[model samples]
Target: MTLTESVNLDNCDREPIHVPGHIQSHGALLAFDAALRLAACSDNAERMLGFALPALGADLDAPQFAAWPHVTQAIGDFAQRSHGTSGLAERSEVQVGGRVFDLILHFNGRLVVAEFEERQPADREIRPFTTLANGALGRLRLQRTIDDLLQVAVTEIRSLTGFDRVMAYRFRHDASGDIVAEDCRPDVEPFLHRRYPAGDIPAQARRLYVINTLRFIADVGAAPVPVHTAGAEPLDMSWATLRSVSPIHIEYLTNMGVAASMSVSIVIGGELWGMIACHHLTPMVVPYGKRMACDVLAQLLASNVQTLLAADHAKRIEAASSVRVQLMETFVGGDGLLAALRPHAAALCTTFAADALVASEGTETFVHGGVSAAAGAELLRWLRSSKPPEGLLAMSEQAKLPPVLSAALAPWCGILALQMDDNRHDWLVLLRPEQVETVAWGGRPEKVYKAGPHGMRLTPRGSFDVWRETVRGIAVPWSATELEIARGLQAELHRAGGARRAQVARDRDQMLAVLGHDLRNPLQTIAMASQLLARGADSATVGPRITRSSTHMARLVSDLLDLSRLQGGLGLAVEPKPADLARLVREAAQDVTLGHPGVEVAVEAPPQLQVPVDAARVRQLLDNLLGNARQHGEAGRPIVMRLEASATQVTLSVANHAPPIPPESRDRLFDAYKPASLNNSRNPGGMGLGLYIACEIARGHGGTLVYEYHEPFVVFVVTLPREARAAAAGEA
Candidate 1:
């Protein structure tokens, strides 16, 4: 669609309404460069403005325009005040041709385009318009709903402009407009419920609506005045108040029998939401001051409407959040997401304002609310087949669906589907019933194409008679808030699923690592000893080695059996007899040295310290702790032990020359099946259950075991009651 192309119904959208090269007859447009040299002026400017029209005019210092210094002074003031911003247009009045005229000035690049319309003394002044606008804004602020707000607007605009009819038109998603609110005189025919097609306002015109807040036509039948410019390129009148509109639009008004018209754009979030349209049966003009006041009201109305909509979404989001909490409660209470959704189906239906839901997980399908089992199956099938790459799809008009599928889910006009996984097998589908609405159009909402003398062209509809339409297979559209909530729900479910899978995998891998490491070395040593004996090596050399290896393996196997029993809720068994705790710790160290001969051990204790503890279990606990130190401590560094006794209890601690345990693994150090380092490259033969068994042994004697990471050292401390007979009995 280029400027050179002839406009038809197919290409009118590119008709370029901004640089029209003309302006309305009621006003003269003059554009001057930064130096105040006239750059462009309307052809009628010589008659309207006493100054001669020049193809390239002289500067402000020229003798021709020296008499009226106010015009030049006003432009200088406007430029100084509106320095860097090219925002809204500013209005003022100047004396021209011995008559007062309204002046509107705005910037288009470096040029200051000014429009002058002859003003009458009867025109409303600026002070009264300020009072009128503030009063209208006060009324607007009192209305809570959009319908009420627009109702007040049309009434106020009609009263101010004295138009026969004034209406607030709201655009639909398709750009067609509906007369939502209207105020008119008694004799005028009311178009209160009329609708207009998008073609009535072309795309380029809509773009200008966002920039120019208000435009007026004193008389639609008046001829347009052409603008003459010195430059080769056409002037851009995007911000010019007197900028002319498309001839097709003028034809549209004349066809509708309108003599005069005015429109104030209702812009929201920088897009044209609609307009406040005024129509008159006789030629009429709204003074500049009054029109500016109406523009302010239109802007305020748009802001209030946007505020109302945001408030509605906020309420809905709050309620949906509460329902989500209840759903989560059900999810954790038992049989997976499907079960959770089954009982809360009615809640979900209300949360999103939906009619029914169909949830599918693998082979299982759950139908809830108003959907029949058969309809649920069909909906599920469609969701899986049409799953988007991101796995969320929303359809507002089910008439767009295939005929077979649409018939299968009759009476439903919307479907919102969320897939549970990357594969399309699982889904949660929300269904909404069709809302059939009847709309009344001002005329048939379409273009009429006919062959003209020049070529084929599109014409405006000839009639303004009422045309009604029954719109069907469309539900209330899914809102942005509902879609955002659905996205959050899907993401949360995926995160929970990932966490569950990781935990299960982690547990299994840790167990396998421990079993492969702890049993491998002992089994290998026994195998080597048996081979050496069979190859005629002396029994004296092999027997003790084989016996020691067998003992270690047997103890490991027994400890594993005890853990298996623990899983069945049994406690470790222990017999308490008075014994020297110091001796037990010493013996445990000596045995660990036999396993790792190069490792050294040191003991610091009162040798005679005694307690009612099971000596064998205490020795086992010591052996496990010592083995952990030997495996992990720096080579050639000695493991240290210390013991202290009190009247009722005794404390024993083991210190090893090893790096401190990482802070993240500290809490789970005493838990079974968790290794010190997640990195598998650490020295092996540690089942990660040493601390668990030691803890259990301490519990058996009514005591506790704990670990701490001091810089450059790892320490395990144990505390036991001096008289453990009662504690042992309690454990049994």
Candidate 2:
């Protein structure tokens, strides 16, 4: 509705008209009970009560409802009634199905006023002033995330007031109440989807609901007040006796079998909205002062709601709409998403605090942008080993993270991660490390941590201010609106991604195009040369040329396949079998020497040192290391291959006369595309995947291959288990 249209009452035919004078004098009243079922009462009683009330079918002479000493005395009083008919009434605090009423009496004559009120437990513990304030703020923090808001609010209320069942009650104009939300104490009956009738809470009683919005009712058994007439000039209702409660209302509760109930109206902007109801099967009393405090809490909550909603709704919607599109676009940019987030690495880390990472499950690839550069390798290893949860995470914390992360991210202080999955497409993650105090540095969210041991002494507003400041400094503040926008944006991006799958396919074509141009031409030239040699040109010349060309082609194919398997998630084929470790070492050394006749190669493999392995893959592994040394090391220096075996394992070490690997390249030795030489002369005609693939192949065979830095020489070691060696020994 337009704002102008809303305010223009003249055009609003259905809108209720309000008179300012009536609002001030007796408060505005909206009629609730217009429809009445047929019922009969005596003329005098009808005149007295001002209405033809329903039949309850009972005498007025009962001792509880009247002043009869016993049932017999009440019968005697009934017998002495006048000739005209008297009023009929029923009172009960027990099981009588249908609408129950309480503390009822009938005088067989017309009454002056028929007021309505419910009996309540007189003693309720008033929450301390400090608790109310602290709790209110705690609720605010809980509301930072969407899913947590309702849960946190319910938990806080249940804990503060100790209600058996504390529920967030919602009301419709028809005078009915439904439990919209509830937080039941442990072991209590779950009330999640429970519904209740509106007649349970009468319209007259609802009008007075807000007075105790923050009240505490301790016990209902001890209520003290002088019974007084309704509408008496000085009628005092602060107590039970001074104000007459409706007999029908009491009967209604009794029939329902609820002994004691406490309700605090949740008023937003001084207007009645709904309520928080605490119901117990047993009677209880709440002290007056405590009740007042509860009212204050209700007022505070109402004010917050009012503040949040009072702003121009359009302005808020517009602000949210503006950024949502871009946020979602950033979330689902596919391969480009990671690159797009690189600049916001710090922002992402601070937002999630931890549990932040950028990953491509499609490629089994992930980048830990939140971790330090020194810790990237470690973080990657962690990501490879750790599994992410399914679907988009609405909001989850690291506390529930699997135990494995602790060992993996041990280098960093604390760890946190949050992820959003794009349908089934990809994942967007935010990771954080403890020492990376984004909270204290950002000052975005105002947080209130639970008070320390000293209850009143350590509120967020008081003793914990210093710690609050620290956390506040590090946490990047994201408003609820911001999160909503981000969520909406992510959803949009997911939709866009579905629409752009064709574009993405085209992009993949572009990648293949680049790959063909950059890689296939050289391979094809070598293949042509090999084909010419095989055509029987010249044995001496073409024989070696054929071998060289074939080896080049083999290397190219091996690199391509290994890269494909790594990206494809197809486990490498590794056949571990009995083989002579000594013979394999000598053969690999001889192979490298044949390729480089200028370099001297020596093997020191013992005849008894046999290992179970795939001989050809092992030979390739050693040849790669030795060939790398010959192609990059000093020509005349001896390249030594050493072999040793333990009872359970065998080790092969190859050392060449080369300077120690540079410090910068040491960490990335096994990383694909990271050659030892940036100028591309380190291993002429070599692809950097040689070392990486060799490492993977060794791991596949349940062994490890690594390089160690030794001054004037770089040593590459391959370690294999004794089972492989024992099998080989037995075979030999």
Among all candidates shown, the one with the greatest lDDT? 1
Q: Which stretches of candidate 2 lie over 4 Å from their true place?
A: 1-259, 263-290, 297-390, 393-538, 675-679, 724-732
lDDT tens readout by residue for model 2, 288-328: 34334455555655655555554533455565564444444
RMSD of each: 16.1, 19.8
Worst 10 residues of 2 by lDDT: 24-33
- lDDT value for candidate 1? 0.79
For model 1, residues 299-379, the per-residue Cα lDDT tens digits are 899999999988998898888888887876655433345657877889888888898888876545677766676777777
| TM-score for predicted model 2 compared with the true structure | 0.42
Q: After superposition, how far is residue 429 of candidate 1 from its true place, in Å?
A: 1.8
Q: Model 2 residue 577 lDDT?
A: 85
Q: How big is the RMSD of model 2?
A: 19.8
